[model samples]
Target: MDTEDTTGDLITRTGFHFHIRHAEPEDEAIVADFFKHVTPEDVRFRFLSGMKSVSHERLVEMTSSSDARRVNFLAFSPNETLLAAAMLAVGKDPQRGEVALTIRDDYKHQGISWEMLAHICRYAERHNFKSIESIESRENHAAIELERDMAFRAYTDKDDPTIVVLRRDFRP
Candidate 1:
Protein backbone atom coordinates (compact mmCIF):
# COMPACT_ATOMS: atom_id res chain seq x y z
CA MET A 1 0.00 0.00 0.00
CA ASP A 2 2.79 2.41 0.89
CA THR A 3 4.68 1.63 -2.29
CA GLU A 4 1.51 2.04 -4.29
CA ASP A 5 1.11 5.52 -2.91
CA THR A 6 4.73 6.54 -3.37
CA THR A 7 5.67 5.09 -6.72
CA GLY A 8 2.73 5.59 -8.98
CA ASP A 9 2.61 8.86 -10.88
CA LEU A 10 -1.16 8.48 -11.25
CA ILE A 11 -3.51 9.71 -8.55
CA THR A 12 -7.22 9.16 -8.16
CA ARG A 13 -9.03 10.65 -5.22
CA THR A 14 -12.50 11.95 -4.49
CA GLY A 15 -13.59 10.69 -7.91
CA PHE A 16 -10.89 12.78 -9.62
CA HIS A 17 -7.86 11.40 -11.39
CA PHE A 18 -4.67 12.99 -12.71
CA HIS A 19 -1.09 12.12 -13.53
CA ILE A 20 1.81 13.78 -11.73
CA ARG A 21 5.52 13.94 -12.49
CA HIS A 22 8.64 15.88 -11.57
CA ALA A 23 8.94 18.86 -13.90
CA GLU A 24 11.66 19.25 -16.50
CA PRO A 25 13.05 22.12 -18.54
CA GLU A 26 11.47 20.71 -21.71
CA ASP A 27 8.05 21.31 -20.13
CA GLU A 28 8.35 25.11 -20.45
CA ALA A 29 6.19 25.39 -23.53
CA ILE A 30 3.40 23.27 -22.17
CA VAL A 31 3.54 25.10 -18.87
CA ALA A 32 3.35 28.43 -20.66
CA ASP A 33 0.38 27.17 -22.62
CA PHE A 34 -1.19 25.92 -19.43
CA PHE A 35 -0.80 29.32 -17.79
CA LYS A 36 -2.50 30.98 -20.71
CA HIS A 37 -5.60 29.12 -19.72
CA VAL A 38 -5.31 30.27 -16.12
CA THR A 39 -7.26 33.28 -15.01
CA PRO A 40 -5.38 36.47 -14.26
CA GLU A 41 -6.73 36.59 -10.72
CA ASP A 42 -5.59 33.04 -10.17
CA VAL A 43 -2.17 33.91 -11.53
CA ARG A 44 -1.90 36.86 -9.19
CA PHE A 45 -2.91 34.69 -6.27
CA ARG A 46 -0.43 32.01 -7.23
CA PHE A 47 2.54 34.29 -7.80
CA LEU A 48 1.61 36.99 -5.29
CA SER A 49 2.22 39.49 -8.02
CA GLY A 50 -0.04 41.67 -10.12
CA MET A 51 1.48 40.72 -13.45
CA LYS A 52 -1.22 40.31 -16.08
CA SER A 53 0.58 37.34 -17.55
CA VAL A 54 3.33 34.95 -16.63
CA SER A 55 6.62 35.98 -18.21
CA HIS A 56 9.04 33.83 -20.15
CA GLU A 57 11.69 34.24 -17.46
CA ARG A 58 9.30 33.02 -14.80
CA LEU A 59 8.26 30.07 -16.96
CA VAL A 60 11.88 29.13 -17.46
CA GLU A 61 12.49 29.32 -13.72
CA MET A 62 9.47 27.16 -13.01
CA THR A 63 10.40 24.56 -15.59
CA SER A 64 14.07 24.33 -14.70
CA SER A 65 15.31 21.59 -12.34
CA SER A 66 18.90 22.68 -11.96
CA ASP A 67 18.45 23.49 -8.31
CA ALA A 68 19.10 20.40 -6.23
CA ARG A 69 17.05 21.72 -3.34
CA ARG A 70 13.91 22.30 -5.31
CA VAL A 71 11.44 20.05 -7.08
CA ASN A 72 8.50 21.14 -9.19
CA PHE A 73 5.66 18.78 -10.05
CA LEU A 74 3.23 19.00 -12.91
CA ALA A 75 -0.23 17.47 -13.05
CA PHE A 76 -2.14 16.46 -16.13
CA SER A 77 -5.57 15.05 -16.78
CA PRO A 78 -6.04 11.51 -18.04
CA ASN A 79 -6.37 12.90 -21.54
CA GLU A 80 -3.05 14.74 -21.19
CA THR A 81 -4.38 18.21 -20.46
CA LEU A 82 -2.39 20.17 -17.93
CA LEU A 83 -4.38 20.61 -14.75
CA ALA A 84 -1.98 22.08 -12.26
CA ALA A 85 1.60 22.74 -11.18
CA ALA A 86 3.24 22.64 -7.73
CA MET A 87 6.63 23.57 -6.36
CA LEU A 88 8.55 22.52 -3.24
CA ALA A 89 11.73 24.41 -2.50
CA VAL A 90 14.02 23.81 0.46
CA GLY A 91 16.25 26.71 1.31
CA LYS A 92 19.34 27.01 3.48
CA ASP A 93 17.35 25.96 6.46
CA PRO A 94 17.22 22.26 5.64
CA GLN A 95 14.49 21.59 8.16
CA ARG A 96 12.02 23.87 6.43
CA GLY A 97 10.66 24.00 2.94
CA GLU A 98 8.36 26.36 1.08
CA VAL A 99 5.56 25.18 -1.17
CA ALA A 100 3.64 26.91 -3.94
CA LEU A 101 0.94 25.48 -6.15
CA THR A 102 -1.57 26.61 -8.72
CA ILE A 103 -4.34 24.89 -10.62
CA ARG A 104 -5.95 25.99 -13.84
CA ASP A 105 -8.95 28.12 -12.99
CA ASP A 106 -11.21 25.78 -14.95
CA TYR A 107 -10.05 22.92 -12.76
CA LYS A 108 -10.49 24.70 -9.45
CA HIS A 109 -12.64 23.12 -6.70
CA GLN A 110 -12.41 19.65 -8.25
CA GLY A 111 -9.94 18.62 -5.50
CA ILE A 112 -6.88 19.05 -7.69
CA SER A 113 -5.31 21.69 -5.46
CA TRP A 114 -5.98 19.66 -2.38
CA GLU A 115 -4.49 16.49 -3.81
CA MET A 116 -1.47 18.24 -5.28
CA LEU A 117 -0.74 20.02 -2.01
CA ALA A 118 -1.11 16.84 0.02
CA HIS A 119 1.39 15.13 -2.26
CA ILE A 120 3.86 18.00 -1.86
CA CYS A 121 3.49 17.81 1.91
CA ARG A 122 4.30 14.11 1.79
CA TYR A 123 7.38 14.82 -0.29
CA ALA A 124 8.54 17.43 2.20
CA GLU A 125 8.09 14.98 5.06
CA ARG A 126 10.08 12.31 3.29
CA HIS A 127 12.84 14.79 2.57
CA ASN A 128 13.23 15.43 6.33
CA PHE A 129 11.76 18.93 6.30
CA LYS A 130 10.38 19.62 9.74
CA SER A 131 7.90 22.12 8.38
CA ILE A 132 6.39 23.23 5.13
CA GLU A 133 5.25 26.77 4.49
CA SER A 134 3.52 28.82 1.82
CA ILE A 135 3.17 32.55 1.41
CA GLU A 136 -0.29 33.42 0.17
CA SER A 137 -1.89 36.70 -0.68
CA ARG A 138 -4.24 37.87 2.04
CA GLU A 139 -6.99 38.24 -0.51
CA ASN A 140 -6.76 34.62 -1.53
CA HIS A 141 -9.39 33.24 0.76
CA ALA A 142 -9.86 30.02 -1.16
CA ALA A 143 -6.23 29.03 -0.88
CA ILE A 144 -5.99 30.12 2.73
CA GLU A 145 -9.00 28.02 3.66
CA LEU A 146 -7.67 25.07 1.74
CA GLU A 147 -4.34 25.18 3.50
CA ARG A 148 -6.02 25.60 6.84
CA ASP A 149 -8.15 22.55 6.17
CA MET A 150 -4.96 20.59 5.68
CA ALA A 151 -3.71 21.43 9.20
CA PHE A 152 -1.64 24.43 8.21
CA ARG A 153 -1.75 27.34 10.61
CA ALA A 154 -2.04 30.75 9.07
CA TYR A 155 -0.23 33.80 10.38
CA THR A 156 0.41 37.26 9.04
CA ASP A 157 3.81 37.73 7.51
CA LYS A 158 5.67 40.30 9.59
CA ASP A 159 7.47 41.99 6.79
CA ASP A 160 4.53 42.02 4.45
CA PRO A 161 1.10 42.86 5.71
CA THR A 162 -0.43 41.93 2.41
CA ILE A 163 0.52 38.26 2.77
CA VAL A 164 0.02 35.39 5.17
CA VAL A 165 2.26 32.48 5.82
CA LEU A 166 0.53 29.13 6.04
CA ARG A 167 2.60 26.54 7.77
CA ARG A 168 2.31 22.84 8.55
CA ASP A 169 4.86 21.38 10.90
CA PHE A 170 5.78 17.71 10.95
CA ARG A 171 6.05 15.73 14.14
CA PRO A 172 9.48 14.44 14.91
Candidate 2:
Protein backbone atom coordinates (compact mmCIF):
# COMPACT_ATOMS: atom_id res chain seq x y z
CA MET A 1 0.00 0.00 0.00
CA ASP A 2 1.21 3.48 -0.76
CA THR A 3 1.64 5.46 2.44
CA GLU A 4 0.66 9.08 2.47
CA ASP A 5 0.74 11.76 5.07
CA THR A 6 -2.46 12.54 6.97
CA THR A 7 -3.21 15.39 4.62
CA GLY A 8 -2.54 13.19 1.62
CA ASP A 9 0.32 15.40 0.63
CA LEU A 10 3.18 14.02 -1.38
CA ILE A 11 6.51 14.88 0.18
CA THR A 12 8.08 17.67 -1.84
CA ARG A 13 11.18 19.71 -1.28
CA THR A 14 13.47 21.79 -3.40
CA GLY A 15 11.48 21.08 -6.57
CA PHE A 16 11.41 17.34 -6.01
CA HIS A 17 8.22 15.39 -5.51
CA PHE A 18 8.45 11.94 -3.98
CA HIS A 19 6.28 8.94 -3.31
CA ILE A 20 6.97 7.12 -0.07
CA ARG A 21 5.97 3.51 0.28
CA HIS A 22 6.87 0.29 2.05
CA ALA A 23 9.70 -1.45 0.29
CA GLU A 24 9.34 -4.87 -1.30
CA PRO A 25 11.70 -7.71 -2.18
CA GLU A 26 12.14 -6.40 -5.70
CA ASP A 27 13.54 -3.21 -4.25
CA GLU A 28 16.79 -4.89 -3.23
CA ALA A 29 18.54 -3.71 -6.35
CA ILE A 30 17.05 -0.26 -6.01
CA VAL A 31 18.30 0.02 -2.47
CA ALA A 32 21.74 -1.09 -3.58
CA ASP A 33 21.81 1.54 -6.26
CA PHE A 34 20.68 4.17 -3.76
CA PHE A 35 23.54 3.23 -1.48
CA LYS A 36 25.99 3.55 -4.33
CA HIS A 37 25.01 7.18 -4.71
CA VAL A 38 25.54 8.04 -1.09
CA THR A 39 28.86 9.28 0.22
CA PRO A 40 31.32 6.99 2.00
CA GLU A 41 30.68 8.81 5.23
CA ASP A 42 26.98 8.08 4.87
CA VAL A 43 27.78 4.41 4.36
CA ARG A 44 29.86 4.36 7.51
CA PHE A 45 27.12 6.05 9.51
CA ARG A 46 24.48 3.68 8.17
CA PHE A 47 26.44 0.46 8.76
CA LEU A 48 28.55 1.71 11.65
CA SER A 49 31.63 0.71 9.70
CA GLY A 50 33.82 2.12 6.97
CA MET A 51 32.99 -0.59 4.46
CA LYS A 52 33.94 0.03 0.88
CA SER A 53 30.69 -1.43 -0.46
CA VAL A 54 27.36 -2.75 0.70
CA SER A 55 27.17 -6.52 0.30
CA HIS A 56 24.32 -8.36 -1.42
CA GLU A 57 23.51 -10.20 1.78
CA ARG A 58 23.23 -6.96 3.65
CA LEU A 59 20.96 -5.55 0.97
CA VAL A 60 18.79 -8.64 1.18
CA GLU A 61 18.63 -8.33 4.93
CA MET A 62 17.32 -4.81 4.54
CA THR A 63 14.89 -5.25 1.68
CA SER A 64 13.58 -8.82 1.91
CA SER A 65 12.51 -9.72 5.39
CA SER A 66 10.05 -12.40 6.40
CA ASP A 67 10.15 -11.07 9.89
CA ALA A 68 7.23 -8.84 10.75
CA ARG A 69 9.37 -6.88 13.17
CA ARG A 70 11.15 -5.09 10.35
CA VAL A 71 9.82 -2.56 7.89
CA ASN A 72 11.71 -0.73 5.17
CA PHE A 73 10.45 2.41 3.52
CA LEU A 74 11.67 3.90 0.30
CA ALA A 75 11.19 7.32 -1.19
CA PHE A 76 11.17 7.74 -4.94
CA SER A 77 11.21 10.78 -7.16
CA PRO A 78 8.47 11.52 -9.68
CA ASN A 79 10.41 9.54 -12.25
CA GLU A 80 10.91 6.67 -9.78
CA THR A 81 14.49 7.49 -8.92
CA LEU A 82 15.29 6.35 -5.41
CA LEU A 83 15.87 9.34 -3.20
CA ALA A 84 16.18 7.86 0.26
CA ALA A 85 15.49 4.85 2.46
CA ALA A 86 14.53 4.26 6.07
CA MET A 87 14.33 1.11 8.10
CA LEU A 88 12.40 0.49 11.26
CA ALA A 89 13.40 -2.53 13.29
CA VAL A 90 11.22 -3.31 16.22
CA GLY A 91 12.84 -5.24 19.03
CA LYS A 92 11.28 -8.19 20.87
CA ASP A 93 9.75 -5.65 23.17
CA PRO A 94 6.85 -4.27 21.20
CA GLN A 95 7.06 -0.99 23.00
CA ARG A 96 10.22 0.12 21.30
CA GLY A 97 11.76 0.21 17.85
CA GLU A 98 14.99 1.36 16.24
CA VAL A 99 15.08 3.53 13.15
CA ALA A 100 17.80 4.36 10.63
CA LEU A 101 17.59 6.67 7.66
CA THR A 102 19.83 7.68 4.76
CA ILE A 103 19.26 10.26 2.06
CA ARG A 104 20.83 10.49 -1.36
CA ASP A 105 23.98 12.58 -1.21
CA ASP A 106 22.52 15.07 -3.65
CA TYR A 107 19.32 15.26 -1.62
CA LYS A 108 20.98 16.23 1.61
CA HIS A 109 20.05 19.62 3.11
CA GLN A 110 16.73 19.51 1.29
CA GLY A 111 14.46 18.40 4.21
CA ILE A 112 13.96 14.86 2.92
CA SER A 113 15.56 13.44 6.02
CA TRP A 114 13.36 15.51 8.25
CA GLU A 115 10.18 14.46 6.44
CA MET A 116 11.22 10.81 6.33
CA LEU A 117 12.05 10.79 10.02
CA ALA A 118 8.71 12.33 10.91
CA HIS A 119 6.98 9.70 8.84
CA ILE A 120 8.92 6.92 10.55
CA CYS A 121 8.00 8.22 13.96
CA ARG A 122 4.36 8.33 12.97
CA TYR A 123 4.61 4.80 11.66
CA ALA A 124 6.08 3.64 14.94
CA GLU A 125 3.34 5.30 16.91
CA ARG A 126 0.69 3.77 14.69
CA HIS A 127 2.25 0.35 15.36
CA ASN A 128 1.77 1.03 19.09
CA PHE A 129 5.43 1.49 19.83
CA LYS A 130 5.96 3.76 22.80
CA SER A 131 9.41 4.91 21.81
CA ILE A 132 11.84 5.12 18.92
CA GLU A 133 15.60 4.96 19.07
CA SER A 134 18.48 5.64 16.71
CA ILE A 135 22.17 4.89 17.07
CA GLU A 136 24.20 7.61 15.45
CA SER A 137 27.90 8.11 15.09
CA ARG A 138 29.36 10.93 17.15
CA GLU A 139 30.92 12.39 14.04
CA ASN A 140 27.55 12.74 12.29
CA HIS A 141 26.83 16.15 13.61
CA ALA A 142 24.06 16.96 11.17
CA ALA A 143 22.03 13.88 12.07
CA ILE A 144 22.78 14.33 15.75
CA GLU A 145 21.47 17.87 15.58
CA LEU A 146 18.46 16.79 13.58
CA GLU A 147 17.54 14.20 16.17
CA ARG A 148 18.00 16.76 18.87
CA ASP A 149 15.72 19.14 16.99
CA MET A 150 13.17 16.38 16.80
CA ALA A 151 13.24 16.14 20.59
CA PHE A 152 15.08 12.85 20.77
CA ARG A 153 17.32 12.72 23.83
CA ALA A 154 20.94 11.93 23.06
CA TYR A 155 23.30 9.94 25.23
CA THR A 156 26.64 8.25 24.66
CA ASP A 157 26.55 4.52 24.23
CA LYS A 158 28.24 2.96 27.22
CA ASP A 159 29.93 0.20 25.28
CA ASP A 160 30.76 2.19 22.16
CA PRO A 161 32.12 5.60 22.88
CA THR A 162 31.98 6.53 19.23
CA ILE A 163 28.25 5.95 19.09
CA VAL A 164 25.45 8.08 20.48
CA VAL A 165 22.00 6.73 21.19
CA LEU A 166 18.99 8.97 20.57
CA ARG A 167 15.62 8.10 21.97
CA ARG A 168 12.18 9.68 21.86
CA ASP A 169 9.23 8.51 23.91
CA PHE A 170 5.81 8.80 22.40
CA ARG A 171 3.93 7.87 25.53
CA PRO A 172 2.76 10.52 27.93
Candidate 3:
Protein backbone atom coordinates (compact mmCIF):
# COMPACT_ATOMS: atom_id res chain seq x y z
CA MET A 1 0.00 0.00 0.00
CA ASP A 2 3.01 2.27 0.35
CA THR A 3 4.16 1.85 -3.21
CA GLU A 4 5.00 5.08 -5.03
CA ASP A 5 4.67 5.89 -8.70
CA THR A 6 7.62 7.20 -10.68
CA THR A 7 6.22 10.71 -10.27
CA GLY A 8 6.55 10.31 -6.48
CA ASP A 9 2.85 10.60 -5.75
CA LEU A 10 1.36 8.18 -3.27
CA ILE A 11 -0.81 5.51 -4.82
CA THR A 12 -3.55 5.86 -2.28
CA ARG A 13 -5.24 8.94 -0.93
CA THR A 14 -7.59 9.29 2.04
CA GLY A 15 -10.93 10.98 1.73
CA PHE A 16 -13.43 10.78 4.56
CA HIS A 17 -11.32 7.85 5.70
CA PHE A 18 -11.84 6.09 2.37
CA HIS A 19 -9.04 5.10 0.00
CA ILE A 20 -9.11 6.00 -3.65
CA ARG A 21 -6.67 4.37 -6.06
CA HIS A 22 -6.09 3.04 -9.53
CA ALA A 23 -7.65 -0.39 -9.55
CA GLU A 24 -5.44 -3.41 -10.10
CA PRO A 25 -5.88 -6.93 -11.49
CA GLU A 26 -6.25 -8.36 -7.98
CA ASP A 27 -9.17 -5.98 -7.47
CA GLU A 28 -11.21 -7.54 -10.29
CA ALA A 29 -13.30 -9.63 -7.99
CA ILE A 30 -13.99 -6.67 -5.78
CA VAL A 31 -15.11 -4.77 -8.85
CA ALA A 32 -17.33 -7.71 -9.76
CA ASP A 33 -18.74 -7.68 -6.26
CA PHE A 34 -19.43 -3.99 -6.63
CA PHE A 35 -21.22 -4.69 -9.90
CA LYS A 36 -23.40 -7.24 -8.14
CA HIS A 37 -24.77 -4.47 -5.99
CA VAL A 38 -25.67 -2.56 -9.13
CA THR A 39 -29.17 -3.72 -10.01
CA PRO A 40 -30.77 -4.48 -13.37
CA GLU A 41 -32.53 -1.13 -13.20
CA ASP A 42 -29.20 0.62 -13.08
CA VAL A 43 -27.94 -1.26 -16.11
CA ARG A 44 -31.16 -0.55 -17.91
CA PHE A 45 -30.71 3.15 -17.58
CA ARG A 46 -27.13 3.09 -18.73
CA PHE A 47 -27.23 0.33 -21.30
CA LEU A 48 -30.76 0.76 -22.58
CA SER A 49 -31.29 -2.91 -21.79
CA GLY A 50 -32.61 -4.69 -18.75
CA MET A 51 -29.56 -6.77 -17.89
CA LYS A 52 -30.56 -8.94 -14.94
CA SER A 53 -27.07 -10.05 -14.10
CA VAL A 54 -23.61 -9.65 -15.53
CA SER A 55 -21.71 -12.73 -16.53
CA HIS A 56 -18.34 -13.63 -15.11
CA GLU A 57 -16.99 -13.55 -18.63
CA ARG A 58 -18.01 -9.95 -18.97
CA LEU A 59 -16.45 -9.09 -15.63
CA VAL A 60 -13.20 -10.74 -16.65
CA GLU A 61 -13.24 -8.92 -19.93
CA MET A 62 -13.73 -5.61 -18.20
CA THR A 63 -10.95 -6.11 -15.68
CA SER A 64 -8.52 -7.64 -18.13
CA SER A 65 -9.11 -5.40 -21.07
CA SER A 66 -6.07 -3.31 -21.85
CA ASP A 67 -5.71 -0.04 -23.64
CA ALA A 68 -2.90 2.37 -22.91
CA ARG A 69 -5.29 5.24 -22.36
CA ARG A 70 -7.85 3.54 -20.18
CA VAL A 71 -7.86 3.62 -16.40
CA ASN A 72 -10.33 2.46 -13.79
CA PHE A 73 -10.66 3.97 -10.33
CA LEU A 74 -12.18 2.48 -7.22
CA ALA A 75 -13.45 4.01 -4.02
CA PHE A 76 -12.81 1.81 -1.04
CA SER A 77 -14.36 2.28 2.37
CA PRO A 78 -12.21 2.72 5.44
CA ASN A 79 -12.56 -1.01 5.95
CA GLU A 80 -11.15 -1.58 2.44
CA THR A 81 -14.50 -2.48 0.94
CA LEU A 82 -15.23 -1.31 -2.57
CA LEU A 83 -18.19 1.06 -2.39
CA ALA A 84 -18.25 2.61 -5.83
CA ALA A 85 -16.31 2.64 -9.10
CA ALA A 86 -15.76 4.50 -12.36
CA MET A 87 -13.66 4.37 -15.49
CA LEU A 88 -11.95 7.01 -17.59
CA ALA A 89 -11.51 5.91 -21.19
CA VAL A 90 -9.38 7.95 -23.52
CA GLY A 91 -10.26 7.40 -27.12
CA LYS A 92 -7.68 6.60 -29.80
CA ASP A 93 -7.42 10.36 -29.96
CA PRO A 94 -5.89 11.56 -26.70
CA GLN A 95 -8.08 14.60 -26.87
CA ARG A 96 -11.21 12.55 -26.22
CA GLY A 97 -12.29 10.78 -23.05
CA GLU A 98 -15.53 9.39 -21.71
CA VAL A 99 -16.50 8.41 -18.20
CA ALA A 100 -18.87 5.76 -16.95
CA LEU A 101 -19.74 5.54 -13.25
CA THR A 102 -21.89 3.41 -11.00
CA ILE A 103 -22.64 3.32 -7.29
CA ARG A 104 -24.13 0.60 -5.15
CA ASP A 105 -27.90 0.70 -5.18
CA ASP A 106 -27.98 0.98 -1.44
CA TYR A 107 -25.60 3.91 -1.59
CA LYS A 108 -27.49 5.94 -4.21
CA HIS A 109 -28.52 9.52 -3.39
CA GLN A 110 -25.70 9.79 -0.86
CA GLY A 111 -23.52 11.75 -3.37
CA ILE A 112 -21.19 8.86 -4.24
CA SER A 113 -22.10 8.98 -7.92
CA TRP A 114 -21.32 12.65 -8.13
CA GLU A 115 -18.04 12.15 -6.32
CA MET A 116 -17.08 9.30 -8.62
CA LEU A 117 -17.90 11.36 -11.71
CA ALA A 118 -15.84 14.27 -10.45
CA HIS A 119 -12.92 11.99 -9.73
CA ILE A 120 -13.02 10.56 -13.24
CA CYS A 121 -13.20 14.02 -14.76
CA ARG A 122 -10.19 15.14 -12.81
CA TYR A 123 -8.35 12.03 -13.85
CA ALA A 124 -9.20 12.70 -17.49
CA GLU A 125 -7.94 16.25 -17.22
CA ARG A 126 -4.71 15.15 -15.57
CA HIS A 127 -4.13 12.89 -18.55
CA ASN A 128 -4.68 15.77 -20.97
CA PHE A 129 -7.98 14.75 -22.48
CA LYS A 130 -9.53 17.71 -24.27
CA SER A 131 -13.12 16.59 -23.91
CA ILE A 132 -15.32 13.89 -22.42
CA GLU A 133 -18.66 12.52 -23.41
CA SER A 134 -21.37 10.92 -21.32
CA ILE A 135 -24.00 8.80 -22.98
CA GLU A 136 -27.15 8.17 -20.97
CA SER A 137 -30.75 7.33 -21.33
CA ARG A 138 -33.00 10.33 -21.53
CA GLU A 139 -35.12 8.68 -18.87
CA ASN A 140 -32.30 8.96 -16.40
CA HIS A 141 -33.07 12.41 -15.16
CA ALA A 142 -30.62 12.21 -12.30
CA ALA A 143 -27.72 11.81 -14.71
CA ILE A 144 -29.04 14.67 -16.84
CA GLU A 145 -29.17 16.85 -13.73
CA LEU A 146 -25.66 15.88 -12.75
CA GLU A 147 -24.21 17.03 -16.08
CA ARG A 148 -26.27 20.20 -15.93
CA ASP A 149 -23.58 21.68 -13.70
CA MET A 150 -21.36 21.71 -16.80
CA ALA A 151 -22.00 23.00 -20.25
CA PHE A 152 -22.84 20.08 -22.55
CA ARG A 153 -24.01 19.96 -26.15
CA ALA A 154 -26.93 17.57 -26.48
CA TYR A 155 -27.49 15.32 -29.44
CA THR A 156 -30.45 13.05 -30.02
CA ASP A 157 -29.80 9.51 -31.12
CA LYS A 158 -31.72 8.43 -34.16
CA ASP A 159 -31.78 4.70 -33.49
CA ASP A 160 -32.04 4.54 -29.75
CA PRO A 161 -35.23 5.61 -28.08
CA THR A 162 -33.75 5.96 -24.63
CA ILE A 163 -30.45 7.55 -25.47
CA VAL A 164 -29.03 11.04 -25.52
CA VAL A 165 -25.42 12.11 -25.80
CA LEU A 166 -23.75 14.92 -23.89
CA ARG A 167 -20.30 16.21 -24.69
CA ARG A 168 -18.15 18.45 -22.51
CA ASP A 169 -14.75 19.98 -23.06
CA PHE A 170 -12.26 20.07 -20.20
CA ARG A 171 -10.79 23.49 -19.60
CA PRO A 172 -7.28 23.30 -18.27
Q: How many steric clashes between backbone atoms does each model show? A: 0, 0, 0
Candidate 1, residues 33-82: lDDT per residue as tens digits? 99988998889988988898889998888887776777778899989898
Model 3 worst lDDT run, 10 consecutive residues? 1-10
lDDT on C-alpha atoms for all candidate structures:
0.83, 0.83, 0.66
After superposition, which runs of candidate 3 have C-alpha atoms over 4 Å from their true positions? 1-17
Q: What are the C-alpha RMSDs, in order, of all predicted structures? A: 3.2, 2.7, 4.6
Candidate scoring better on TM-score of 2 and 3 = 2
Rank list by TM-score: 1, 2, 3
By lDDT: ranked, best first:
1, 2, 3
Best by lDDT: 1
The lDDT of model 2 is 0.83
> Residue-wise lDDT of candidate 2 within 1-172, one digit each (tens)?
1233312125645755677877778999899999989999999999899899999988887785465778788888778888888888877797899999988998788788888888888877876789999999999999999999998999879899999999999997
Off by over 4 Å in 1: 1-7, 10-13
